[model samples]
Target: MERKRGWDTLLSADTHHNAVGLLAREMRRASSPLYYPIALCLLRLLTREKTSWELPAMAFLVEALDCPDMTEWSDSILEILSRRLWSQCTEMHRLVLRGLVLLSKAPGMADGVRSLTPSLVELLCYTGGELVGMVLSVLINQVQDRDIPISTPTALRLAELLPPLFGYDNIHVQLLSIYLFQKVMELAVDKSKQLLKTHVIYSLLPLFFHWHHENQDVAEASRKALLRAAGLLKRRDLVKLLKTEQPWRFSECLLENDKRRAVEYACQALPYLESPQEPVREAALRFIGIAGRYMRGQRVELQVAINVIEDMTPDSAAVKSLALQTQEILRAVQRPQSSPGSSSLKISSRRCRIGRLLSGAAAGGQRRTYSGNPV
Candidate 1:
């Protein structure tokens, strides 16, 4: 019961790690009910005021896992742990994640895990390698075994962050990010399903591109995510196409229903023209062509797509043909030149922003390709 007296060594000594960790470890196995006070003592030391003490506190906390009463402190443990997952201190943050990982397995921890969605999604933007793998494994835990409802705001942020990761070099990241996205679609609050509609709409073409991924798992994940997206958008026709494995018609169906965003969708599809995989390039080129049909007066967006397509040097003859075919499709439909008296060609600020973004992505792709890295 006097466990608090031994806690000072955690903050003051370089030698306490082994002793504290060992004591915490042995406490978990002791016959008497002594672990809780020790665990509670460790938890109180996890504050920012004692930066030196935080890691030891978390380390001892982890060593005490499976202690008979661990779950009783879950909410507090989760609260403190969730706040530290973003710690700038690398080892501290990792220990926090490891603690959360163990804490998450206990019953009734779903709400705590659900609150973690935004943090994990945000972390995906900044971390990679083993850190990314760790964050993703924890994120996968968040959505599995039960429905962990995410807020509309979190869904919106996640929807934005997840698409770019569809091509992450790490196969695990690529796979987990896509799978988690589908759960976001399924478990987001019902009313926000409509709010998530626009994001879902934007994801269709990219998901379709990855559907041809060489990695069977990634391809399957993309397909499943696209299916969930279609269901969320209430596009039964598109759903039937995906369910039936008819990707060729899926792009056309998607554009036919949402023709208005053709310009936006086409811009999003432009960068995939440089994809190392021929099938992805071919899929992107094909979709851009169909999307071109809907771009009659979208002269600015049309020419932007053409400029990027012109940079494509085909890996296969079919890609070359599709490139030209798409060129012709876009060329034939571009609105005629302004009348003689017309002022400068007016472009929307929105289109200008899209143009800049596509150009930046294409440039990034080239730089990374030259360096043999994933953008």
Candidate 2:
């Protein structure tokens, strides 16, 4: 009674740090009598509206979370952390991640925190390398087990997010994200496999390009992921080429097999042009050249690729040369086709416009039209 009185007094007196620490230490020391109320008090503190109650309270909860046998409190603690993880406060984010990482290490807690997967997946797109690595680390743990079976909804979103991170600057981030992507594809609920099919298919080119990444571990992970992705896609030819490490064939195979999305695929490769690695940029440009052949006369799509490639004033002679070659090929495909009768069609269309204007002027004498349609 006296200890509770002292704790309430300190909180009421604004002993933010010292009092929270005092209570947390007591919880850890005497888990017998005082653990329940103090721990519950800290959990409730996370719900308080007072900004003063946030940092230290979160710190206290995170500290207490590091101990083992949190089975009883795992759900509540995870619930609190997951809710606060979306907070804009960086300090709160760090503490929430630390608490999550610790909890994720516990067996069976993976499901307790699995609902946070989509939010964490989006976090991979943000700036902090350490934060990205932490998010990937937690994700890798959550879905690593083959039996876990990520929900269909989470798996679809995961497929969308992981493709861009294959080129993330951090090595560990790259490896874990790719590997986790593979696991998500493998363990996603079977009923929704068809729903995830297109996402898996789109990932192939990115995964194929990354397989050539200079880092052997990243390269190997990409290869493994590509193989699994191929299996999901049921492309026996890709599987055979992968078995022989012949990624050189992925482009022709990709463009030949998925021509409907050829323009979209070319657009997908657009971002890789800016990759810091020359090899990756080289691959993206080369693929754009091939994609151009399939995109014949898709002027807007073709010009978008041409413009983005032209925008890069690369330091490498090879990349610059390839960019020019790709633009020339895409521009050639972008040109309008000539035929025996096309010029008369243009003359007739012009006559039709003039005839419409004359009839409108005859009908409504006040009707007006502008000739400044730009020469």
Candidate 3:
């Protein structure tokens, strides 16, 4: 205990990393009781005054795991964490778990990780949703040993835990899960089958349907994660959820404030949702109105509006003009379809047709009055 206190005090001075490095070196030879103190010290130093000390502290933990004698301490470390899993405060337990994650990156820590998996699962089961999110972050980011790899069962556990964390009660937790899912998508690209089998693909819908989170950070993260999952699953149905909802939500976002950024994301997200369907076309048109007007005749917004109209217009010139304004706003689409050969020249031809029709009607009305006078 006295030695532990001495090392703890040394970590307090923050003069240099040498003491921390020396302590990490000695931890390999230390007994089971000392692991907690040593782990606690390294975790402290990871957040020391100098940000540069972080990687060295992390490396120190990795190296300690490489020591041949460390295996004997694995069971005890797991036991300590397991007991503290429920009783301890969230932050303190998370620190130790973070260290374990860093330590698991080393090849020699395979036994350590295997021994602790059960306890980690227990934490996932019993902790608050945010705590589970923290554990998921560490797992998705740090646990990358091919030998001690993430198993299907473990991934399923993570997927099951995500729904509640991202459901609505905890915003921070939802944001963190979004980030984790993005990472998982990148890492598991080739393992799409296994990833989907684990129900990682289905896990995202709760965030979309259940929580209408409009906060910028959470919304952005959710967007990226859902897009990634959509790509992995290669399912149009999954993509539909985002496609159907995001534009209206974005338009609503534009109305509130920061119309510029809202418009920007709306533009970036549109092509992903494009389809040869009425709902998509109609929604795209609605978004154009919101985004176009919000951007207030910005070139890109105008161009996007023109493109949507070109693709979606009916034959009526008045309706076409309604959908596709040529700065005059009075003209409306009158045609259901424009011929491909004449579409480029159709605008001029359509104007002439309307002009001639009006001219002939006026002439006929005058001739009828003259005929009545002569009789």
Candidate 4:
């Protein structure tokens, strides 16, 4: 007890190396009850010291003392370390974080550290990529334990953290965040799964089709995770997800299936023709062309397509050409199937001429009234 009391005085007096040496010598005496006092002294020195040298000494002491026997001391140490996260010292934060990571890996230390989930979630918002990755690693390990379920609040906090990181600038941070997200989605219980679907799926859909991502591994992982999400979601839920998340998928799926429902949903792609993205506009026009074959005599749908085609510019010549062909096919299919004679063909030719005249007049901002009089 005298030697332990003297060691605390030495630790507080700025002689950190000598204090650490004494603590190490005392720690070697396995039966000594000096671990708690030594741990308390090191934690105090860790939190109070602003010097660079003492930080590593304190961290080294904590690491050296880490064992199953020291598990009971984890809560207090974690609390002090978590509080240190708010400090302005980056080195101190790094030391505490490294200490936490080491402690979390020790036998019987994970459960105690798991209680710090709220603190860990808050740390996820830390701007430092290293800090965020360490926090994610700790949480990932904790969640992998089936016996210890993550609470709803922690899960929700994690969901909030996921979106920004999915597009994070750092590749390692991006990959680790994604891996943590996948693990959470897979391990979440049924109730948590619903929360994820409601909050997360909308953000994930674009990644499934992010063909431009430089990293093939990230793109492939996103695609696989998206397919997994699709499997778990109901068809109606998926349709809802695609409507706002990736409307192109919804339209493409409708076009591929060609169900009766496709007719109603095919119109959804019309807005995409006016999208600023050239690819989106082209895809929209392509879907419309395919759907028009089944839309013969559907005057409303055909008229909508015509108006869209008329709005196109020379820049969209490919789209316009496809739309024009589709318009002709639709008009041909509108004629009565029994009326396949030359007269029907002449009518169709005259109708095309009248349609062109109307389109030209409309483009020139001219309006004409047909009062049962010859042109």
Candidate 5:
């Protein structure tokens, strides 16, 4: 029984290869925490000089991943396990993520993962650039696979992990995080919309607006994350966060150094400004004006502007004009406004009609009239 301090029977080469069956049998026991240490031992074996066992270790992990009780295992143990594996994780990243994806698909896993979510969130903050990107990518895929809702602490944990990642010295991690976060927002459940207001995501503004040291890839990632989060939540508080967080300084930075991303992030916020509070509307319009000016000729930026305008109130001659102009610009790229654009225009016009009727009524009277509005 003389064993290494960090090593256990599950790590023994002979036993570790057989761990899937061992862990599976124990999985059904009442004291589920027992498997936590066992899982950690397997993780350690995988990270150590035990190449002969890689496939079997992965198989073991895959099995544990399938076990219904896996998430109920201890948080400290999982953290230790992930930390040990972080540097040496290699191709295991996909496997671990795939495992988590499978676990998430199990009807009861979220409830279990919920208990250890704080630990999982902490892991997001601990790893280096590449490892963090791998972790987030895995989590995103699993979330998509399981159709996990965004309001859960687990989802927010994943969101909060992205901003700091913008500072990561690696361009690939930054780009990967940006790409995955966009997909995550697009795939998130509609009911989780209100959770988007949480300040965890608000912290990203500084990175989006002021981080001059970052390269285009980092800047692009920051831009995409802000846009995606804004589109999902539609909260003006995000605007205030950017402003109050550092207005004069950020303005100077954007003006002097990196206007492209600032413009992109601002353009993304415009669609959410439809009938917003005066301050929010003012801020959004200001950003759109700046973004629009810079975005004029570039085909991609122009396309984004067109999309923003299409999503806005059609009654505003300003919004309508911008959209119409965008159509003309897009025409040079290909052909005149296509079906998607025309359909959006029709839908936006109807929204504007509803808005005018409400605006014409006294504020309090209109409140009573549309109190039952589903939205």
Candidate 6:
């Protein structure tokens, strides 16, 4: 009774210097049962004051209250701290998050902290790397233990929250964000599985090709996650993903496992041959050259390849060389019974005619024409 009276007297005093020091000292000496009421009083003071002094007092109390055996006390503390998370005082908000972090580490306390997911995720949008890292660390622990997977609703909410972090400037934030995503990928099942694959995969595509990421671990993790996702995709989806101007960048990763699929992927590269970006055009042409053997019976595909190749200027030596090589392969496949020497002569004749047509078109002397032959 006297101790409670002392606390009340200190709190009621106009100057908080005496109360703050006394609370800090008592929190350290207080026995297990004494922590609950002390925590309540500290919370009450923090709620009422929002003073710098109260912030440290509450932090001290949180440290004292942090213990695995005190689940009920931890629960109460978390409940009060969660409310204080919305406090406009930045220092108070930070101290509360720190308290939550410490409490989250206690055994069996994650379940209680799990209720803070919505608030924590909302906090992520505006917080700095330090707080963001702490929040994510807590969340990572929440979903990581197999015996106690985070609820599906919370998992899905986390998935929705993760996409933007991919673009954050902080490397730690980016890496932790990806780690959380990888965990979700491993944990999601049933309907949640469909949600992650459909909504999250698109956002992850850019990361797959982050080959220049300064951190090799992040780059490697991105590659593993992308390949894992690729394994889940169908041939049609792979082709659809390749329809962009730079499909070749991902082709080796996405289609290399299957030869027939790689050939079909090459067919999709035809449109990219005209891409304004030199690298895109070059990769498209190179893919066609490698897959030329499969273009034997693909007459329309061969013609498209030949037409795009013929459009290239002589200055683009790399593109023209690959184009001619691809045309030669198509010619050999067209006439399997013919001798190599004859095929070479035929290729030379076709090249001369195509060159004349190109020069004429360049000179505005005549409209370009196609023989529509495989060559």
Question: What digit string (tens of lDDT, one per residue) describes model 5 on residues 1-375?
Answer: 223222365676655534544454456364467765666577666555557556556655665655544555434324434443443444455445445445545555545444434554576776654556556654554455565555555555555666555445566776666665565566556554456455434544433442222254554455445655654555454444343443222333343344556555555455435632232233343344444334434666656655665666545444344345434433343323346646887656754543443232223222322232211
Off by over 4 Å in 4: 1-54, 62-72, 145-147, 209-212, 235-251, 254-375
Backbone Cα, N, C clashes tallied per candidate:
0, 0, 20, 0, 0, 0
Candidate 4 lDDT over residue span 277-373, tens digit each: 4443554555565565566567777776767766776555554655565556555545544455557777768666645633443222112211121
- Against the hidden true structure, what lDDT does model 2 obtain? 0.74
| Residue 183 lDDT, candidate 3, scale 0-100 | 59
Query: Which segments of model 1 are wrong by more than 4 Å?
Result: 1-69, 72-76, 115-121, 313-318, 334-375
**For residues 62-83, what per-residue lDDT tens digits would candidate 2 score against the true structure?**
7777565446777778878878
Candidate 6 has what TM-score? 0.53
Candidate 3: which stretches are off by over 4 Å?
A: 1-111, 143-149, 183-201, 209-212, 236-375
What digit string (tens of lDDT, one per residue) describes model 1 on residues 1-375?
Answer: 136545565455664654566567667677337777867777766633556666667777877665656677777778787777788977677777777676667667767776777777789789876677677777668768767687788878888888788887788888888887898899889878888887887788778888877677888889889999988888899889878776666776888888888888888888888887776887787778778767878888888888899987656765675577677666756757456776554434434543444344334323422232111
Per-residue alpha-carbon lDDT of candidate 6 for residues 54-151, written as tens digits (9 for 90 to 100): 65576556655554444655656776688788777665676678778776776667778878877887787778767788778777767766445545
Q: Write one digit per residue (lDDT tens) for candidate 3, span 1-375.
A: 245554554556442344554555566457546755565565455434335454345435544543545555555444444444454544445545655665555555556555556566657667764567656655644544342345555555655665455543566766776676555555543444455543653453333322233355665566667666666666554456455544234333433444545455445434422333333333333444444434443555555545645665354443343344322221222233356665657767765654454334323322422222111
Query: What is the C-alpha local distance difference test score of each model?
Result: 0.73, 0.74, 0.48, 0.58, 0.48, 0.58
TM-scores of all candidate predictions against the true structure = 0.71, 0.72, 0.39, 0.52, 0.35, 0.53
Which one wins by TM-score: 2 or 3?
2
Residue 180 displacement (Å), model 3: 2.6
> Lowest-scoring 10 consecutive residues by lDDT in candidate 5?
366-375
Q: Would you list the rank order by TM-score, best first?
A: 2, 1, 6, 4, 3, 5
CA deviation > 4 Å runs, candidate 6:
1-53, 65-72, 150-152, 231-375
Better of 2 and 5 by lDDT: 2
Name model 5 segments beyond 4 Å from true.
Answer: 1-119, 145-147, 183-195, 198-207, 210-221, 232-375
